[model samples]
Target: MLDDQLKSQLAAYLERVTQPFEMVASLDDGETSAQMRELLTTIQSLRSDKISLRTDGQDARKPSFTLQRVGAGTSLRFAGLPLGHEFTSLVLALLWTGGHPPKVEQDLIEQVRSLDGDFNFEVYMSLTCHNCPDVVQALSLMAVLNPKVKTTVIEGGAFQQEVTEREIMAVPMVYLNGQVFGAGRMELAEIVAKLDTGAARREAAKLSAKEAFDVLIVGGGPAGAAAAVYAARKGIRTGVAAERFGGQVNDTLDIENYISIPRTEGPQFAAALQQHVNAYDVDVMNLQRAKALRPASQSGGLIEVEMDNGAVLKSKTVILSTGARWRNMNVPGEEQYRTKGVAYCPHCDGPLYKGKRVAVIGGGNSGVEAAIDLAGVVAHVTVFEFMPQLKADAVLQKKLASLPNVDVVLNAQTTEVLGDGSKVNALAYKDRATGEEKRVELEGIFVQIGLLPNTDWLMGTVELSKFGEIVIDAKGQTSVPGVFAAGDCTTVPYKQIVIAAGAGATAALSAFDHLIRTSVPQ
Candidate 1:
């Protein structure tokens, strides 16, 4: 049930509904079912003239409800209470089902409408998952856009038996036509591209036809966004080609070190970054991954950046801001058991291990924070640190020490992950002090070691440090003339968001300086 403040907000949102809809409930004599009834009744009370609630329905899953537009073929179902992070998804579903147009691009809308197939999508998501809302909203919007598509969002917490049966240890697990489609955060564009086979070709053609930009950024995280904004302000053409707009920031949970803002979550900050970049006249090419880079043959010649889709974009100067990703534990069985019980995000996957023992690999801030957070939901947490002492802050270590269910082990090196060919069952490590091999029986393993730069694609192309980070000077210039680098991919000492953004600004300014000094080839 919603509070008075929430009800007031819902009343205002319901006014956007242009058409009438019904909430048909399929319930049984259960506590969750009773709560579902109350929630539906409360929602129907907000706009009784346009909304109606009906009980006495039969579906395999109790405590579920179906949203159907009156006299329209659009319909979707929610098999659990859409509270917490999914509340926005539920609101959008209601509005979209009632004929309220979504704020997405018209092209994406048309793509969904044009997709040919009978798609029955089922998504298992946790309420606390920050990434689940994106997938849920995407699928829900598709179901509303095309009649042949139907989506059912199931809350994994309410349906634990189903999650266990499927061995789903992650949130936002999507099943299309009863087959696993994907897991993790997915935007509407990504989903449509997967469904529409010709999307990549069309996008490549479109990108290839674009004109040369004054500044071309290779990533769309904090650095790329800042560079785009700064370059666009210089009255020159600017463009950003990115695999995903958020980059590694999308996987981040909390960000508090940014100067201006006191605190913000990763996804929210990423959205704000995209919005800020959109405010400028920069051309943004999303879902574009750069596979290769070619420097200009002569002064004033355009540098070419090739995409995985065969599209080549030319620019006067290229700013490589491709960010980093979570470093994986390369031990045997680690890759084999990924998503089967080995997860990188404790925030997203921690709830799945309720009352189960899990291990956190690392003793830094991320690892300690993950262990502290998981201690409340999981039965026990064991932390393995490769160093002799914890690298986490004093405050964090103090908090971690206070938890009774957490055990910290220093000088422990992870050797291998043990699984039964399907899911993780234990983790093997070596004691550096005693040279003793130890194995801990657990259900899940969260790796929080560090980050690996996204510069593997640029090997032999740029001057890279021993750690594979791009070698950059104070001005953010790479060894290759006309090609600058910034952010986590570069040799920046600190990998904080604020530092990346400042580095981005510096790169953009340096690129402008280079443009002014270089002579135009006649």
Candidate 2:
């Protein structure tokens, strides 16, 4: 009973409404492969009622649902991916198909509508990581809000080989316009700022003083190096300020485990990592220290850094990776015997003491772990604990007790380290009980006391935890908005080299996201 004109109009409406639904259904197949076929069939059967589709088939029945498209112009986007917490995304996708405008905060929505350039976004995430979901949601919302933006979510497991090939060891990483963003969860405001302003791309460029970079990372330790590499790889103008280039890695004797690289020596491994950064054209300012960071309130903002030789450098963003120095035992002969017989980090120096007797000082978990680790590499390991009993975990105590080459001396404290000019020869100790005094002959002494964060120079710029470590959120963001912190300097629990590297990557990506959101007009 429909006229030709009416049928033509209905056909156009059906096509407009059904095209986006079909595309969304296709995506669902990938998201839930097993249930996709059945779900699609059921949804399609209800399409007539769900949508006001006028059909002439003899099997026509009452439609089950209605379709209301939202959003106007070419700025339409799917708010959710229809996966996990993305249920709302499905609704938004349908709304986009109907050529209607979405309801968003008036001011923010207006700003988004004004964007005109191409914005490419890709978020990297791992299945096991807890913080990735939040980051994914934030990114999805950004893509939905801006019509000029196209977003993709990459599963870490699916790209495991690629990630390993690129030496990517972090989760919740966001890459926009080839520049990396957050390694973990970040605030929406920060992400928007980075994207809008092109700050991240500028940060990745590695521009010279004549054309200063947006970001300059100081130090070449695991943290610093990671930041530099990530920033530069993202096409940001980035540079590194390092003293002696490799930082603490030069002093490392061996690196048994650092995620991808299972076994490596400190210097050689550090050199390889540096080469990776260099490959990406990151500028390396060797033998330099950023003595101070003074902020400049310019258009892009600038940080004036005073180098050691009174040379001043300027940049838009500054990353402080000036790692901490080992707190040496101030006992007179201790300084003279360093490397010869005194060492820190038993895992790095244990091999050198093989088949030789060694003394481990301190009673913390690190001391106990070192003692246990050294027992396997040395002829004998003597642990000197000032406490009445070992302060390590009960499990560690049991393990150490089981080791035939390990011995624990309770209520004993090292008074001085005595050594021949060439090497450490022995240690003088006093026992609290019975006022007992003893001297033990050993080839090496491992100090496993603890670590101090390198935040002394930071003053009050950022919040510091009770232990002086920088306080950062899951995304490596400090209390300050523009500034971020990572690695051992931050309050993240694990202090392994891999963890630090991951943190550094996260910080750089988060900073990039901030830059992007700020660069664009919206």
Candidate 3:
């Protein structure tokens, strides 16, 4: 069950086990149980005398083994076999329990320490997910730091019943206080904020009393950040409220088409945007989701921006740069296996599947583009489209046709995602015409159907296109006076990062112009 090279790596990692570590399990007569024992034995042999595993010590919750620091109720446990991407999770839990706490934000540590009651965090992961480890490590660290918090890292494959019951479609599905927190790649703070501790509600109440602003930009993605910077440069009272900045770009993996910069990740670029906004006098309020918008008094008066948190801000002018989010297929296994074999941005997760077979779930421009780009890196590429013909531009379709490793399947509806509890290994689709189900075996699935503007809140408040995109004119002015919009959230024709940034600057200039011409001197 173990190899020489892997054993060597495990041995080197265990050298840092400054303190004794133990794995307690209750193994009976079964293949899974027997295999679990063998895997543990192999690991123990590799670590020499530093690590130990006991098969018949105790059974606290069914047939399971608990991992903890020698004697303490470390509150870190593993329910199933820790293999695949979770192998690193097991290693991290051991390392931290042995006394090496990761260097994280002081605020994060405090949040963990300030817990009022016992909290159980369950992070479900697959062996092949690249983004699962971070969630696992984060929750595990939180458990280790706070005695009131315990974390169970479950390998999605090891426990099929729980996966089905929980409707886990994506990996790294976090459960906080026994409720589904979030799925896919998510920051710890994002997950933690979802906890109903009354603190968030209180923060919302506080924001409800915000003062009027010269310019208040909603949506904190690239457009919002750029607008904030430009507005603040004018030395005006500029405020930016967003659920999270960087918008759809946050969902993007690798961003190489941002003009001058050759390459940068989505999160990295977002951080840079935040830093730029911070350099100015902009009032940056993150994690504040806009819930409603309307003119404070008259059609041209200060616009009232109501937040989902119950806080409100009044500004003379507002810029809507809420941006857009990836349109999910909403099929089974799509969410549970995300970052596992299921992926969205080819640019970001493509490198993870080098030399492996993958599938593109749409035949549109983005889907075809992803297939073309991935073909050069992966061993093979398959494109599945529900339509009878590819919707990609003629140029892109021609490019795809020329790729030797790429193949397209028209009129195919993705029926389901097939995986082995840990990672996706195949996709099931039905031929639209024949209604016959077909399955394609591959390592990765990229869904690029299209984008959905994050403008649901603006529903009737502002003029919107039939597709829900905010409509804006050449000067970034929306149908509503004293309001402007930019980036993917608007009908701006394009949705690239550079375009969004430029749009943001334009919207800010317009808002500044509106402020100078209309607002009374302070």
- Which is the leading candidate under lDDT? 1
Worst 10 residues of 2 by lDDT: 57-66
Encode model 3's per-residue lDDT on 458-505: one tens digit a residue: 998889999999999988999888999999999998777889899999
lDDT of 3: 0.80
Per-model clash counts, in order, read 0, 44, 12
Candidate 1: tens digits of C-alpha lDDT, residues 1-522: 799999999999999988898999999989999999999999899889999999977889888999998887776999989998899999999888877899999999999999988999999999889999999999999989998999999999999999999999998899999999999989899999899989999998999999988889999999999998999999888999998997888888889989989999898999999999999898999988899998897434789999999998999899999999999989999889888899999989999999999999999999999999999999999999999999999999999999999999999999999988889999999999999999999999999999999998899888999999999999999999999999999999989899999999999999999888885665
Measured with C-alpha atoms, the lDDT of residue 244 in candidate 2 is 51
lDDT of 2 by residue, 291-346 (tens): 55655543246666666456666766666676666655567677776656787757
Q: Best-fitting candidate, measured by TM-score?
A: 1
lDDT of each: 0.93, 0.63, 0.80
- Alpha-carbon deviation at 403 in model 1, angstroms: 0.6
What would the TM-scores of all predictions be? 0.98, 0.50, 0.69
In terms of TM-score, how similar is model 2 to the real structure? Answer: 0.50
